[model samples]
Target chain A: MSETTEKTYKRSHEPVFWGLFGAGGMLTAFLTPVMILITGILIPLGIINSQNFSYEKIHGFATTWYGAVIVLVLVALPLWHTLHRIFHALHDIGINRGRDWQQVICYGFAFAASIFVFTLLLQMF
Target chain B: MTKRKPYKRELPTDWWLKHAFYTKYMIREGSSVLITLYSLILAWGVLRLSQGEAAFNGWLEALQSPFSIFIHLLALALALYHTITWFSLAPKAVDLWLKGKRLEDKVIVAGHYGAFAVVTVFCLLIITL
Candidate 1:
């Protein structure tokens, strides 16, 4: 094998994706444990979960709305980041060889997965 | 037939992707792990609500614990960071089809922050009420 001969092409992704990815990450880092505390802890303990629990209507609204909005952001944003990140990773390894087919497949998988997760969450609650 | 890269440069293949600084940046790049976890908790809250007040109370009690409180504060900080960055970055992704032209990034980002401020204040008032 002679010294490196072929030049590989690498296209760095756009900034918007990275920016959103970072934001989404920060969101989960802070939000998850708190949610876990409130629901996973509060509900299961049988203390605050009562027929006449304070602010029933408000509680109901908060639970439903928070869940719905978050489900959208959770599944979609991460997939976007993953698709962009993976392509770059592949480029680094120099395996893609600049084929449009590869891009389509990788991106397609991420999109399909996002749709599936979103659909599942919507259907469930 | 010949191919052309209008923007061409000779860069060591994957050189930019290899630096320690760049690696940390990439780790930070996919902060959506935080979002997925964030949403899952909300979904859990929804389920608790459906289950009834006792369930919700149980959840709240767990949250009130010292360990949980620490986690909540940490999470809040992370969430605030995400929201600020997301709002700031909102402009570039928008598709504003005005005479086949798009709006500027700064304008789009500004619009998001403005909307965020308005909504946040509105929510605060409602909580007070």
Candidate 2:
């Protein structure tokens, strides 16, 4: 009974994930519209020729060191952002069970995918 | 000692749909899925590029399909909504001070938009020029 009354504060290690989430959110915010404009609107409307993102052009771009880094950041960060939201949304919708495993799976997938992308980009160079 | 019972409120499964703000927020959060889809497509492009030129070209052509176009359009709408909401919320998260005075929210928001425009131009130069 005394143990139950004792004050114990457990800190959630959400800051780390939050940091990634913020960065990802910021990047996605600033960039997604531009991406949509170029790929979705321009290409489909033929406002910009397909040759702009042609295989040779994209391959050349990706092979460059800067391009690889940009691609890695773009692909990985929003992933962390998405998974973080989905993880919290699960709780919001009342799936409060198995939180520990949920966190592992949600964040673990982003970490693994990021690593996978980094390695693949490295191999291209 | 008084016997006290704390009030308990249960969260509805569709709590997000219950209010205007909650619905808006949920939509913003849910937009992340579209962002993820775009990221995966880009990542797939990278992977294909690593495979070979033929594979990459094939993928590019495949992107021109009607289904692909429809998906991209959907992604664009979701992404646009995400960007607008995110930008509007940016100033709240960022605190800027100048000469011991706090900056106005408009200034901070404008700064974000300005930076976004500059980056967009830079990217356009890289991709289209």
Candidate 3:
């Protein structure tokens, strides 16, 4: 078989997505396990009392500004990060057709979820 | 005239599992699933909070199940693995310059760990309060 011809292409506008991916990655690396420890292990295992995250306390926390910010960051960034990875994984797994549709769906879901969560948090305030 | 046949080797889809290097890379990439799960869980909690105290309490009680605990343990393991790999790579993505010289990789890596520790403590403080 003959070798395929080489061609030049313009750079992709993926830096924006990469920026979100990096931020989401950093946040997940630092924060996710800690959150699991508190909610999953400590509370369920009785290491820390269950009431620590009781409805009253948690609701109060949600109404606070800093709490809202934390929740927003914690929820939104990881969504972007995960969808971004899934998008690339699809290409790696060789379903490379319909690139435009794939990009729109994957990133679009992250965008919609972020907006939805932000709106909910604002409504709580 | 003579005709020649083309030789080709198809890559298996599970090729990543065949080598330790590829396996590690795939696992690191896949850790995003765990991160996404935790994010959704948190978002759900926030949603419950917005609904009112009863809904939030129900959500908290749901979290107390043995199944939930198991999932959390699994998530914690994946999250830790993600953290280790991500931190080791942090210096590559971040640049710090001082006195017209680039900082050492060791310094950057160490700084990430230090900041991680501080953040962990801050989280604990906030949670316990």
The Cα error of candidate 2 at residue A119, in Å, is: 1.7
Query: What is candidate 3's lDDT per residue for B1-129, written digit by digit as tens?
Result: 669888899988888888998899888878777767777787787788889988977887888898888888888998899889988988887778999888888898898889889988888777777
**Ten-residue stretch with the least lDDT total in model 2 chain A:** A36-45
- Residue runs of model 2 more than 4 Å from their true location after superposition: A1-6, B1-7
- The docking category that best describes candidate 3 is medium
Candidate 1 ranges beyond 4 A from true positions: A1-55, A59-125, B1-24, B27-30, B95-102
Report the number of the highest-DockQ candidate.
Answer: 3
> Against the true structure, what is each candidate's TM-score?
0.48, 0.90, 0.88
Instruction: List candidate 3 segments past 4 Å from native.
Output: A1-9, B1-6, B99-101
Q: lDDT tens digits, residues B44-106, model 1?
A: 544554566788556555555767555555555555555565566556556886787788777
Docking class of 2: medium
**Candidate 2 residue-wise lDDT, B14-109, digit = tens:** 988999999999888888777778888877877888899888877777777888888888888888788788889887888779999888889888
Weakest lDDT window of 10 consecutive positions for candidate 3 chain A:
A53-62
Q: After best superposition, candidate 3 residue A18: deviation in angstroms?
A: 0.7
In angstroms, give how far residue B114 of model 3 lies from its true place.
1.5
Which is superior by DockQ, 2 or 3?
3
